[model samples]
Target: MKVSLIFPKLPETSTFIGTVKEAEKYSKDKIEFYGFPPMGILYLATYLREKNFDVSILDQFARGYSVERTLKWIKQENPDVLGFSTITTAGTGIISAEISRRVKEEINPNIKILFGNYHATFNDRRILEKYPFVDACIRGEGEKTLLEIAEKVEKDQNFEEIKGLTYRDNGRIVRNDDRPRIENMDTLPFPDRNLLGNVEYKNTVEGLELSVGKFTSAASSRGCAFQCSFCSSSMFWGKWRPRSPENIIDELSILEDQGFNNLLWVDDNFTISKKRLLKLSDLIRKEKFDFNWMAEGRVTQSSKELLNAMKQMGCKILSFGVESGSQRLLEWYNKKITLNQVYDAVKNSKKVGIDMILANFIVGAPIETREEIIETLNFSLKLDIDFPQFHILGIIPGNWIWDQMVKEKKINPDDCWEVGTAVLPIPLSEIMERIRQTHIKFMKRPSYISRQIAKTLKSRYRQKAVLQNIKNIERWDIWNSWKPFWG
Candidate 1:
């Protein structure tokens, strides 16, 4: 049996338009290239390969789309099954649908097409109804379920027995019972890195001095225990399941041996287990492994002692969700961390020489007063972190906040952006203007802007590039554009 997994490429501007400067600074391109290695697809590929299925992975991000070329490759390989992974909302789904349509129409009509990931998990019914080219959609974690489905498809067996799958039966959508989440992550084989050929890791952006080589991402756990209303992890994974420290260390050792020097722990919350973290740190230290790692966790999860120990154990960076500065807003969002925790965590991280990135405020949230927005900005600036990202509030389809806002008459169901995937009723002009004003206010702070400008100057090589960016901002009038909204 032969199986193929495809990660459809998307326009760089679509993904990183708001953060172009940051993207360019970190990578050689003006956009954040690639979709972070499509870990889910790789996991499924590994499972199929281990089961003796001929599996191949294609990343459209690195390889630009040429329908003729892709179709030619498909025809030449002639895989028995095809699978696509998608994210929340229509962005990835639309791309997957187009590819599926092309395959059905141009390449091979008989090839079984399947979809998985967050979007399919939540919007299976809608997808089935709209895109008939997709033979099935897998809900929730697909590593095991996908293998079962692939076996059935390969053998021409009944697919109804497969759990956690939605498929068309006699012109009706049939959704099978949900599959149980995998508890033992250790049993799963390490991801198939052969899928991503010639992997190189530098900050990718022009001016950054940090060149941690051939970094690979690994998930130490699944799900989040906290109730962050805007987050989809809790809804997707249901409950938290962490891999043992030994298992995690084993995988790290594998990656290290494979010439990957930097590791990114891609868990929703890596700091959930202090004991496990300390144990892993101790093991890394004991093994004398030379690698730098980064992870995202709650702001309050680490202490000065634990952070210091993490640095000693080759942890170079820490990312935290300091969503808002306003205590009231934080409480409303169910972040569960106090303002003091943010301050202390930043202080401790700085003291330990660990780079820090704060996921900052979500602008234009319902009932959000202008004062609260300013307060959030002030809090972000007060932290004095190495990097901060301010994002507009997007009500993703599966999130609790998305449903709640709709129920409360806060979000207009018809309003959408980013090719109808992002929910934003507010005019784009208004949102962009607010962002520009926020940027100006953030840059006005000499201490903060100086570091940011210095970083940009250091990262950018060609003077023309910097000037062009400045000219682009000037033409856009990001600061002054908010006048219509103010009135």
Candidate 2:
């Protein structure tokens, strides 16, 4: 059967602006560097093709297609089954339902519509209840479930017996038993990069490429070993599992041969196991592979030796989730790492000549005071990091924080659609004001100001990028601030 898998275009208000227009506008007229392939759907398409089915991927986000354009394309494909790989961010999840509705009503009503990935996995019943256009949701890992659904549709069989599926029967919602997470990482086929079709992916620092050429993302492992309350990763991905070093390297070899010299390991926590990491680094160096890559590291697990070895393998950047500088808040979030660990990790990475150190901090968690927020910002300024990103905390669904918020009536079940679309009315004026002040203080540092001048004078691209970064700091003012979450 002909199948079409789509990654929907994000809402305009989405904080994530990876497309050309949004990226350029938000980056202060800098070069765009945010677009990346939807690896999930690509993997699904590969599995479907391996099963000898005709499959195609519509990467609306990467291609920057509009809702109308996406609908038009799906109508043209007219596949027997249409699947959307969705996420519960920036209202993309709710918007996916609308897109599905349009496909069912305006296009071929006979087509089976399926939604999968993080959002669908958690809110399967809600989706089936609210959006009649969506036929079913493939909860958790989707490869096996999706194949079974497609097979059923092809053979005109009922979906009643399918596990890991949530659908409607006789106007009543029916959610099947949950599917187990895929334990064997090597059993699955490589993501079908061919579905990407000339779509070039790259990783950049200060508007320059990470390596000599283009880059794409890969996963060395799945799930997080730590349980941070503000995160939904553990609930969705279950336990942490790493692929064999040989399996990871083999994929790297494929990408390198295909002219992708740089990679961004999108693992939830690549540094969870130091032994596996050192082994992987050794393999990369021993194989004589000349490629630059980046990965997220847990501060508690990072060490000087691991950072140094990763550097030897062309590790250009390492990101750390220093969620808050406040030790109290860190413990509240169950980060399980002290502020000292954060500092040491940064120091070690800097010593190893890691090109970039990107630290992520969340402002406005439960009971966070104005002073504590400033303390976090001040702590970030003192760190030996190249870049830092500050974002307002979200009460994500199905997380420990979400449950607490529900208990306190901070969130209402009726507002699920609103929350999914990121339209929840939470006033963040105080937080936004602090963000503005923090940016001003951070940017005014003598060394930072000097680096800005040097980089701006280096090239047109660098000038634009640096100026844009400066403008973004100013853009945090109340008038230009993002919507705040209300408790």
TM-score for predicted model 1 compared with the true structure? 0.84
Per-residue lDDT of model 2, residues 1-487, tens digit only: 8999988777887766552434445454323334556788988999999999999998777667788988888878889999988787656777788888888889989899898888888788888888888889898888899999989999999889888999877787888998888999998888868787645554544233343356688888888788899888888888998899999889888888888876788889988888888898899988999876778888877788988888888786789999998999898898999999999998888777676678999888767776788889888898977667788887767677778777887767568633542212234776677666766666568998785565446434344444555654433232322222111
Q: Which stretches of candidate 1 lie over 4 Å from their true place?
A: 11-13, 17-35, 199-211, 409-428, 440-446, 449-487
What are the lDDT scores of the predictions, listed in order? 0.71, 0.77
Once superposed on the true structure, which residue ranges of model 2 sit more than 4 Å away at CA? 21-33, 204-212, 417-427, 449-487
- TM-score each candidate: 0.84, 0.88
Best by TM-score: 2
Q: Total backbone clashes of model 1?
A: 8
